[model samples]
Target: EVTVKGRFLNQRVAPCQLEVRGAAAVWGDDGRLTQWLSTQHAQGTVAPIAAANGVAETQVHILTPDVGGGFGAKIGAYPEELLLGVIAKKVGRAVKWRETRSESMVALGHGRAQLQYITLGGTKAGKVTHYQLWAIQDSGGFADMGTILAPFMTRPMSSGVYAIPNIECRTTSVVTNTTPVVAYRGAGRPEATAAIERAMDLFAFEIGMDPAEVRRINLIPKFLEPHTTVVGQTYDVGDYETALDKALQVAGYTELRAEQAKRRARGDAKQLGIGVSVYVEITGGVGNGESAKVEVLDDGRAVVYTGTSPHGQGHDTAWSMLVQEQTGIPMDKIELVWGDTDLVPIGTGTMGSRSLQQGGNAVFAVAGELVNKAKSVAARILEVSEADVVLDKDRGAFHVVGTPAVTKTWADLAIAEKSTGGLNHNDVINVSGATFPFGAHVAVVEVDTETGKVRHIAHTACDDAGKVLNPLLLEGQIHGGVAQGAAQALLEEVMYDADANPITSNLADYGFISAAELPSVTVVHMETPTPVNLLGAKGIGESGTIGSTPALQSAVVDAVSHLGVRNIEMPCTAERVWQAIQAAR
Candidate 1:
């Protein structure tokens, strides 16, 4: 048996590791190198291969097959995965190399193991006066994205939805012996929200004020146009109070407290808790705009090529909806393709929740151009001026005024144009600008005073990603994001030993939350269309994650507040909770 020892950081304040070994063949080959990758950013992987084998990036063509899941860990190529190409070329055979779940935990990058100290000064009425946050980000050895990610995330969203005038936030990324940290779901935004929300709850506890009341006093007033935060981000548009009130009403906060009071009165084993978080995250900030190509084939079908790569975010269905809305193409007749460098050429692979707002809007823009181009072509064939040609979207045809009989279908126009100018007039159309999405989340948890165990009872989130192109797809994104956020709050953690050795290196020790541990998530949708893009859509991918983490953590602490426990660090495990309760007693 080939033995491997892996270490990882645990959710608790300790380091742990696991060992596993098996008889296996682990090498790279041409077939596996070309087949298994699921990302469009191939430069990182191709560079090392070209150096090892004396070939150019053009020689190494990466094709993404069905990607199971990439949470942000799969954005670039890994060293072991790239070795397949070198080994395959050297042996003149296709090679295969797949890591077990054990290897994946330590080798793959982890996220958000920061030690934060936050202080907030606010009025007795709960309006925030001044806020300060100091973050010691545990970067886990190498500074892979996390170093830059932490500062950028905290700077933009340190104040969340609050209208705080004085905000002081500083972060220092430190190196530790562990897996390198990288972007995961909301990236650094979740950590930022978590810190500030926790601070708000702490301030509420100190001043004997309600957490919700404190939030209300500090939240920015309802506004259109831009509202700049103490940090540098200018919120394009939001109604922070509306989202908070809606979430509170839907959650039935007062009723929940009454139930909690009853449980406390009876000294019941099951305790009740409530937590709330409001956040505004920056999406489509990975530069601005995205590339999209829409083509009307001779058969009258529409083909869309988007620069956004989707692992399971349902880009296919969502982009198809955009094409249908603009070009009157039936959903089944539209084919959406992505993640291939040759087909897409240039693309910022999906991360930072930018796909729908940036990439989807680009698709909408290209589809609109296709409609106008077809109208112009139809006008030429019907012997009418371009202004006289009108597209009947209901009929999916172009008809001249006062001439219903003289109509040309999209298919007819494309076929007829082959003789006049060729397959397509323009190869591609690019769209500009990015959109911001915001949300609020409420979490309820039960804490066992004796055992220090925290259980998530309920979670409700309200997210607005501008105009949702597809409700089904948007809800799925929120579900995944909330689960990840809860996991970070109550279970997931990356740890290191005194000698900088990693522990909790695999799934068994890593504390990744599963369905068995999670409660059914409640999602509320709000639409406040963004004026920045043509589709008026913002990104929904990371909003749930950014808004959920702190809510859950605060709820756990709130559950035992009567016992004199003021602050509790994240991942409130049974042991940590028990210790906090013991110290309080």
Candidate 2:
């Protein structure tokens, strides 16, 4: 039996296609499209699509409507999309091409098919000193980002929440005649957490130490500034020990352990298992910046153009809040426009948890600039020097210093500017840097030794993604991410037969998780703001996914630890668990 079973299968969903219509054409200088289809980078597509078509970049006009749901799979422009325009031009009619769900499964991008081997060493006293990981990534028919990025992403986070002195991680991506790999919720970072956390547990078990205490002994001391790991990840700020403490406290770790001991003493048929995982992930995507423009329209309403395209990160509401905070415009008066490159000519687009820190920072920066412009305009209009102007956020108006009686509404200043020129303020926030978001998750499960059934009971998590801008949205992201992570550990996987044909190809065959399989999560809040961006924030988008996957997988293994079970692979199906139990016997 493998002493260390670390299959951190933190992956996301498959591609589902819909009927698409229209002629794909280049945009003319008149800022009109010859024809179009659905995409996020409407304006951003012009140059690249035109170049590919041997036409002027100016000929491409892309339009993006609010997507139904992409998760990350729909971001690329495939050969089929390029062919749509060509076929339309050839046939002289609007071209419609839609793939069946089965076709999408085979042709579209797939997420997170990785195999990892981990080894961790520490003192018998439970102080982890070293870690090593080797991974094999299934790139599938083509070399997509998943094959190239996941393993590289794995190295930076190789040590996870522990302060290991020596660490090494190596991965090889091999292509197969299968669906191309792509980015999922947590991408490569989840695998790192999975490996390290499991190794920590194995170390703890071998040394007869409590898992929680082992984690505490090895975590980096709390740092208010950036802390660089031996692996070369510079965390802007973190309180990993506190996150572990909070998660343990919330899960009643001591009580659970006591219960576990009594159950073990009695040789109970149903065993209680507890799992813990602490993780820190890099966000904002390797220094790629985002863009935004805050324009005070002639009508006094605020319009924000941003490059961070969101599938469901609530960019609209979040961007509006950022603009209103700086510009003294009511949330209702602020409008967010994006994905239409004509309206927002430049943007990096959203993926990799970059929308807020990069995209929102751009909006915040430019909105502050717009307010400065408004201050000057208000000063001139109110017969006061620019230095004498101040903004009253409560009133959404600007007034002369110490002269509240003379005020100008944001709308009034915009109308004045439109009479002369445009552009109150516009800027693109560029950062050749990244932010790290950290968290701890605990999972409780009950395993039926007789039938080898695993039932997830309760879950508790403490995710610190820096300063939270919106608690509701952050929690929503956490809930969704946790679900996906848990599913990967216990129920989900993309499988192939001996012939390299897919076995789990559809919903009927694939183990897509539903509410019936999960328990509500208890979230403990914490924040250690990153200095990486102006928002004092990190990425919460993938935090839960990275943390929860290992926690659940470890819990299942923990439940059967008394059975001499050391490791069990992911999607811990009853059959697999039973087989492990039998082999141990």
Candidate 3:
């Protein structure tokens, strides 16, 4: 068994710790290295194997059998793994190379290297007057993917869910000797949310206004139609204020604040800080559609081939739900297959949360077509008019009106049609369109004035990614997003020395937040169904990241507003918070 594990350190800088302790043997067949890999892009890994073996790219076929999890870190092929194939070929023996967790941290790519200078100008009455964010991103050595990741994440959602018309955001990526930055959970959007949310709290403190009240005044009011931002993308639909109010109500913001005041009066060690952030994230932003092929077999079983790849996003469950809803196919009878390039050659893969909106929609459309085709075949078989026949979904078969006894099961219909032609239709059906998902978040945090230690106390989020297909899967997505966002706010940071040497090189050194550090995230589900897609679903994968980061940061600063503190940089670590408090004092 080849066990490969590596921790990606802050993007490009990966000091790997690998151990190959098994006997190296050779199959002695075709002299090809056949090893299982968990990679996002398979073709990208084949090149090094071919080059190292002194053979053509065709000689090396990198097959991704099963991937545990890859938050854009598994996109490209690594050099060390490629060397295994070469070593196997040179020695005419089988060699195994597996990475350790320590090695994975330094080797895997990190995300969000944005240094932001935010200046918020609002009124004493809690009206947002002006907002400006100037960011300098550390691209981390080679400008891998972070170059584009930073700007797309920082500039697009600069204004967030607010109606701050005088918003100005300028960002530039600077190369540092560290890990090559790539897309993490929320990628660059989380960085933007973090900066602006923290800035909102600073403005609220400067004006001596409640953080919630300040957000209410500035939030973009509920809009029936799409609204364009200063950054140029148009939001399909959102009730920003309603989301905020719902989240606040669910979280008991007023009570939390009352408790915070009590803790401060008694000089309690465990202080309470309430944070609120309003965010609008762009999901399915790539504008590319997903491909799905739904086929009904002779045995009444249905097979669904989807272009949207899923690691643990429950694509099997969610896509099967879509198929069952559209066609009368039962969940058990349907099998969902994906992630194989040969099977799904033409695919955009899964990134930027495009799976459900684009891919799921495709599945729905295909299932509809399959139902129509089945109905036509049933119409021919029963010698009844096509319009007169209707599908009895409860029975999973087509029945004639006023003649329920004369019904044909999908399996019988498929078998009856085999003598005439095939089960599938001749024409190819495809749906090409993209949808947008948006939401708001409220985060509560406590800050120690002396130590500057920021602790997350409570978090509430209201995200509207249109109609939810499955609430269970949706909640999981939100939970994962909240964890990543909270990590960005209170604990996680990819730091480097002055000469570009990475300081946080491993998971032990890097502050990856855990359940012990985070609060029980409160999710207030809101639906502002968009007309853009048939399923009325938008991407919910990144909403938590976009909304939670800002809220948490805002809360941290809001907790210490009475001390005359204006700003605190991301991670809001003990030292940074302490220094900010000292400077204010």
Candidate 4:
């Protein structure tokens, strides 16, 4: 039997605060308060302010312009935001507030900061049989979104990609004199994945087996139908093994192992280590669904209004592509609008990797509906039966099925409907359930045994995001996610002394990752379409972070494991690595 135990820390994210932005409000004489803010969710900001000020929801209005960055910090309504309206009414004038960079670091909500205790038991033959986990979450002086993450996010994914027959998990959140915890990029899922991956590596070390092979022997088989785990979490579909195979092949896993062996034989001070991680996460699961509006102007240009706010996710380009694909409108002619309560009053407001899967799905559905509406108008203008009219998608026109020359363009149809509500379609789309996007990542590192300095040499990531609409955008998202993941594993951390005074409170003190520190990542593409939404797409927003954090951490530990080291805590700094090595010797 093999027994492995370790404590994994998902350190707090302090720098993910509102940057160079402010909120302004004016109390109008008509008993309406209009405000403009830098936030990911304008609708989310409206209701709270209205309720706190003792006014109807319609009395409060919010408009969010281009936000620099949110990650997850701007999703909720803050005390200052709720007080802006009251302050404006009291002063009888417009009021505005913006935090300095130093203040933003401590005032804004933090993320992660969970301490996990994990244990795994398995046979000598490399089959994991039982797994147990206990997570202690730091809610940070207030019960916020981070309080429920352990139960709703970590516990549900405790089984991970493996088919362990017996599993037990428990979670507890304790209030501490730290910054309030909120969702970061991968939120609770990353912490869950990190815990399980660490346990798997430790178990492999105990049995003297290759970690990758141990994982392969225990992974869940690919399933098309919804499959539920022992922990009662149901996955829509997953092909974890295929993702693993692709990652290994792309990373030249055999050559890496051979190099490591040679280094060990020569007793080289610098050692090569390879690490692997397979992960599946939930997306498009935040709310019931999303809302979208598609309209054709008289000039034939299309417009899309979505409830999903875009801080930096490139929603304008993505939503336009969906409109062009469905309605035959050119990408350049499409316009996107969002984040204003008057313009887009109903919205779920982009979190949980839900934008592309839910918001884009809604746009795809509404644009298709607009096409049908245009066809009906075209049939009336051509004086033909609706069944006889056929749309020439390449030409963006409609005509009789047999005749191609005489056609009605989208502009013409819009002009004809000008007397009516115009050519427009808007609706809130509801999907059956959430989507699970799975992937694999392999990280290669060179560690100096004497000094315990680690250098990330190579990385290969295979993320299956389910029917990618735009490869450029997908790759960009993957690259960004990888950078953040690497930061959490090897560079970034938020620390405080015993009295709760932050030690690394500002950028100068924080170990933020930079481009110079990261290797050029090789992204391996794989697609498995989902049946839950119309576009058959899943979320790529958080996959890179989910896979890379564990891979990097595992690589650092594996580099010095021959010295009898079982594990080292995250942000595997040189000091920590050296301490572990000396203790092991």
Candidate 5:
């Protein structure tokens, strides 16, 4: 039996630096208030702004322009944003507010300031059967979204990819004088992964077993149907072991371990360490559903309106592709509209990795519905039954089953329906349930024992986000996710003085990860379509961040584990590693 315990410090960091908080509000000639802000959820902004200003939801209109990045920081409406309209009405003119870099650090909600205690018990042969985790969350000055993440996000995914029989998790939130915490990239999911992964590594160390082998033994068997964990969180579908095998193959796990053995035998100053992690996360699990509308214009072009706002995720390209695939319209001719309340009207915004699975699924469903509506128009013009007319899809036109030469194009259908509402379909699409996107990661690092400096030399990530829509877009999400996860593991921390004042408020003092510090990532693709959504796609947005964090952390710790160093807090800087080594000696 083996049990290990430590605090996984999820240091705070600014959500996004490129785009700070800014808002413009105007009290129009009418009683309604028109406000424009950088936010993830436009519909979400309506209720709060309406309540604060003592107006109806219809009276408040929110328009979201191009947002640089949200990372959950911009999801909630801030006091500054809420006051913009009130201030504008009082001043009798349009009001605009932009936060300075220094102001944004304090004003923006922080993320991932949690302390975790984890314990694992099993046989000496590496069959993990029991697990327990206790998370003490820092809610900061307010009981915001951060307050509930521990129980909601962390506790639900406590079992991860392991088939541990008995598991227990406890969460407690405390109000601190520091900045209020909100959701970050991975939010509470990363904290959960970090805790269990670190425990697994310690368990491996005690039994003198390979960490990878230990994980392989404990991973849940492949499942195509729904499977519920001991914590009562049921996953839609997962094939965790295949993902692990693929990641190991791509990363050359055996070769890396061989090199580490050689370095250990020679007592080299620079030691090689290989870390592996298999992760499963819940996505498309938040909110009621998403809204989507597809309309064919008089000029034959198509327009897609989505409830999922795009800050940086390529919703335009991806959504357009879904429309084009259904309507046979060229992608260049397809346009996407979002973020404007006057336009979208209803939205859950883009967070929790719900955009593609929920929002994109909406687009795909509505586009298909539009095609069906168009077929009736084609049948009316052709003087035939609706069943007799079929869409060619190649030409974006409808034709008789046996007569391809004669076709009625989308423009023709739009012109015929001009007397009515034209060729369009709009609705809110709901999924059967949340999907589980699972994956594995391999992180290889070189640690210099003398200086206690570590270099992340290689990383291979295999993420199964269900059926992929766009390979390029999927890769972009995974790459960005890996970078962010790697940043939290190696560098980036929000520091505070004794008086609860932030000292690392600016970029100069903060340890933000740069492209120079990251190695070119190797991404492996895996697909296990979920039955919950029409598009069969889960979420790739947070998978890399979730899987890579623990792998990188484990790699850093494994590098010095032979030196009697069991654990080190995150942002494993040279100083921290050096201190850990000295303490071990």
Candidate 6:
């Protein structure tokens, strides 16, 4: 039946599959334990490992050094991490676990294994009125935090970017004879966006309407402040339509339609298809706060300590920039310290895209406090009242108001302060709520009708994750996330046989996409600025993965829709596409 209602991981992230990092643990003789780990969360890892090993919390010292490609998999203590501590205790020696690239395929956690059932009701004019989603999440042999949290997270995102008047969602986390599923890229949010977005496309197809038009008709109107969806997530400021408009403009959607028309008119062997997706995802969703400490050194340089951990998010460089912006310190002269429990005992660690908005904001806040503290010192040194002291930020010095030439440099104050208790400030930034970073994506793909092979052609995205702190880091996050999303849509999947034997458990056997497979993504930036925090920032960590999957998958199916094909399962491989085409015929 038809209706007129409508509607879509890696470091360096190169084409080749990269190796997962290793972990080593050592229990010392002083009843004090030390661990050398490569992880996204040092404090996040220590507590669990300590509990599992029957050690006191104070006895554990966790150190993280130069981790690579954590994404979401390295946030917590895995079974392998516990194994090291156990072995080290019995053998009286340090134990380490280095997973080979092939071993990681089976030993490491897998993500996004869900059986979803979605139904949507909408008007012929493209206004979505009601929606429903149900899913069976495969928790695999061991149920971890990711499995426990997936269903809860999925419910709040049921409404996605639309203002559907009525909505219902349900999910069951079940144990299966497969590798345990954990957070990867967008985690449960991606699954939510995927289902709703797919439902919208299906509704559009049934109603014979444009997918983009259907989305626009149902989008939640622009909001300058907090707007709560029916599903219970309160989004910060956003203009979803503007993001969509920008993506359409950059993608040249009208021209793409003309090309598709010609291809269909001629019944060409290769066909053009375009897919559109508009999305909103929650970031800093779990722990909405992070801690920071800033100290002004005698040399006029700054040292920053942060609770949030980083694998590839570049907290060092990003936090330095935050300090530089707030204080007169040069970005190069600022030093960042993180992920070591011995040095930083209290931390929330990194997960759920909470780092920059929480951790980075703390850096900015503490630096500003340090500047205020320095003002009194400047007044004393310059033989003036506190009211007379003013910062000359351009010259990185403090002087009396309207007296730029009579200035005392930060180095001078820092040196003087060394004898009078060096200036230091610490703070924790707590946002009122989790921010909803929204955006739109357009994917264009070419299909070879004769072979059912899909070729990625052009892609454009408008990601609005409130106030980008570092444009380069933001782009890198998007680029990396897009690659992982495209992989799941077009190729990668963890498989198991009837006997619970792992299949496609190695990079060679599993289909991982490469640079040769992906097109250069054209991204447009939109900054709506969240009011929840000082930086006016939200999380960009998972936006690309949340938006790219459906866009690419929908494009593949649209390419062959003229031939009666309506849907194709994910990992839309040549075999699956061929089978769908044959059955449709």
* lDDT tens digits, residue span 301-356, model 2: 88888887766789999999998889768899888888776677787777678878
Tell me the TM-score of each prediction against the true structure. 0.91, 0.94, 0.87, 0.98, 0.98, 0.95
Lowest summed-lDDT stretch of 10 residues in model 3?
Answer: 1-10
Decreasing TM-score order of the candidates: 5, 4, 6, 2, 1, 3
**Model 5 worst lDDT window (10 residues):** 1-10
lDDT of candidate 4 over 1-585, digit per residue (tens): 888888888888764543655899898889999988888888888888899889999988898989988888888878887888889889989999987776777878888999999889999999999999999999887999989988899899889999999999999999999889988887899999999999999999999999999999999999988999999999988899999999999999999999999999999999987889999999877987889999999999998999999988899999999999898889999999999899899999988889988999999999998888888899889999989988887888899999999999999999999999899999999888899999999999999998988899898999999999999999998998888898888988888998889888788988888888899999999999999888889999999999999999999999988889888898989899999999999
Error of 4 at 521 (Å): 0.9
Could you give me the TM-score of model 3 versus the true structure? 0.87
Per-residue error at 133 for model 6, in Å?
0.8
lDDT of 2: 0.78
Strongest candidate by lDDT: 4
1-585: candidate 3 lDDT, tens digit per residue: 111111111222221212211112233366455544666544445566567667765555445554667666666656676666657666766676666675566667766666677777766787776777777777766877778765776688788778887878787888866777777666777667666666666666666678778778888888878888776767778788887788888988888888889987987765676777777777776546667787778998888887766767898999888878866779999998775555554455667788788888878887888789888889998999998889888888998898889899889888977886646532223334445566667777777776778778778888888988899899998998898777777777666678766677667787777789988877888888877777878888778877787677667766776667655666678897888778888
Off by over 4 Å in 3: 1-36, 41-62, 80-96, 417-422, 425-434, 447-454, 498-501
Candidate 6 ranges beyond 4 A from true positions: 1-17
lDDT value, residue 143 of candidate 5: 93
Candidate lDDT scores, in order, read: 0.75, 0.78, 0.71, 0.90, 0.89, 0.82
**Ranked candidates, highest lDDT first:** 4, 5, 6, 2, 1, 3
Model 2 stretches astray by more than 4 angstroms: 1-48
Candidate 1, 368-461: lDDT as tens digits = 8888888889888888899999888777788998887878988998898777663343233343555667778899998877677788989999
For candidate 4, what is the TM-score? Answer: 0.98
> Per-residue alpha-carbon lDDT of model 6 for 1-585, expressed as tens digits?
333222211111111225475888787779877888877789877778889889788888899887776767777777787778888888998878887776777767777777778779877777888887777777778777446644677778878999899888887888877777777777788888888888888888888899999999999999997888887777778799999999999999999999999999998999998999999998887676778899888888889999988777889999998888777789889998998898787788887888888888888888898888889899888889989888877778899999888988778888888876787788776778788898999999999888899999988988998988889999988888788788888887676788878777666788888899999999898999999889989998889988999899889989999899877888888988889888998
Model 4 scores worst on lDDT over the 10 consecutive residues at 13-22
Better of 1 and 5 by TM-score: 5
